[model samples]
Target: MCAHYESPRDKALLKKHFAINLPSELAKRDVWPGYQSTFIRRHENADVGDDAVPPREALLGSFGLIPHWSKDDKIARHTYNARSETVAEKPSFRDAWQRAQHCIIPAQAIFEPDWRSGKAVPTRITLANGEPMGLAGLWARWRSPAGETVHSFTMLTINADEHPFMRNFHKPQDEKRSVVILPPDLYDDWLQAGPGESGVFLRAWAADELQAL
Candidate 1:
């Protein structure tokens, strides 16, 4: 699970890459579960008609996902990552997947542990080209008893036991896995994807395009 990652602080790069204007300045940090972060997705308001232009927007949201029907926020700690193989069948992610509530979680880098030395050594991973990585995710909106609305999301991950670079992380005895990082060209497609077409983008990213520090 990718529990920590560095959110990009360069607003210019975010505008240039995602083509959306941010409502406020975002601070840079090694984001963890329960932390507020930025994400890009199509506007959910019905007022924004389907035929209207410029349907996508960037918004601030919590890192962990909370299903609309969840009784409390504690479930978020375990819902931060939804396994690709069972996302559509899992109770926490099934509704979001079925409704096509897709999103892109931009990151400057992601932190992982290297256990080769018999002890965990922290390492940061980023794109070899130095561009921001857009991780595939699913967003949800939960209404609290007090009528407050909470927005949260979960990163989608797939088994990577055979991947050259991703397979290097995690315990040697545990199943290797990696988050789905979408290419630049696929950002819009992913956000607008239907339930039937979303599965096509859930594969492992190219290893040669990434660098681990």
Candidate 2:
């Protein structure tokens, strides 16, 4: 499954999506797939802009995780998402899951697909009013052999809520569900304020905060 996110504003276009901007000294300026994002450390880089120096939080590193153990460097492409279900135990994501939480790439809306007749149709999911949206994600910093630092991010997926409108996208709902839909109520908490698996938070979003078309 793939994800599509839009800008922080309420528009159907793709260019306006909010991507994390890095400081000029941030080292690597590489862009990500779909031209979607380049993640930065929230505590270290969140509030600072490129021109703004001495950012309150130091520039820790960029997203695209660099497993503290890998000596090869290309592992990032495969180590993106740390599945919420198995994150606590996975070697790649486990370390950051409970301690080094990173911010995710957010959007006003994201798209999924409905496959039928051996073809795929895209469906856009967003808030009825069109506010910014967030996906579950993990981040990492990779230091190039040259020592330049780059950041990267990954989108998390759980079983889709598959409202009557979006069900055509995947498979039988009773089987294995996969896609994580975040709701408005859980937005703040998931991003900066809650605790636990947050079932209450997950249910709220799964209920009605989304509209897929």
Candidate 3:
């Protein structure tokens, strides 16, 4: 259920790959981490993923999720999409899923599904060598009463089998499937270890990094 993704990628394709700088700080964002660009998450607390580092921070939230003893915001219109197997048991994401983690939603493509007969054709996925990839994130920080605070993010999914290129677009999921991509070297271990080895180093990466079109 990736929905749609493609973080723009200008500034010379993130300065020809990492070592970026030019995301001043929120100013009407979301052209896919826009407002300045260069977006990536996972580090609600840290536990691996190269310790989840560099040129990845463009928070301007609102992909659903506004928990913190919520009093409004209608359950974030459905709380975006969080299901890394129930995000540790979601109650607005169990303490940000064990102190929150898993990020990097930079991109090149993402739309999802060819579900076929029941409709939903769409399909996009990417990086079978097309480069650019990152997804699986969760971020939060809400406050406002006099001390404004608003940082939000969410994007994590699984279930999409056999990828010769995102398997003709995630065809499995009638139940028990796979989707979501990342692992070009743990993308920073998930945030940088700690939290009991960052969920076993993000379930161990190595899906050959990616090639899912």
Clashes of each: 0, 14, 24
Task: Point out the worst 10-residue segment of candidate 2 by lDDT.
Answer: 54-63
**What stretches of model 3 exceed 4 Å from their correct place?**
1-10, 15-22, 25-66, 70-83, 94-104, 107-130, 136-141, 144-146, 154-179, 182-206, 209-213
Per-candidate TM vs. native?
0.94, 0.62, 0.30
Write model 3 residue lDDT over 1-213, tens digit each, in one string.
Answer: 554566644656654553344355422223322122234563234334565454244444555556676665456556656777777788886666677454555667656666655676765556656666666566666674556676556666654444334444544555423435556566666644444554443332234555434
Of 1 and 3, the candidate ahead on lDDT is 1
Given candidate 3, what's the lDDT at residue 23?
59
Expressed as tens digits, the lDDT of each residue in 93-196 for candidate 1 is 99999999999999999988878788888889999999999999999999877888988899999999999999888888989889999988988889989999
Note the Cα lDDT for every prediction shown.
Answer: 0.88, 0.49, 0.54
**Which residue pairs in model 1 clash with each other?**
none
> What order do candidates take by TM-score, descending?
1, 2, 3
What's model 1's TM-score? 0.94
Which is better, 2 or 3, measured by lDDT? 3
In order of lDDT, best first, we have 1, 3, 2
Query: How does candidate 3 score on lDDT?
Result: 0.54
Candidate 2, superposed: residue stretches over 4 Å from native:
7-41, 45-66, 71-73, 161-167, 171-188, 191-204
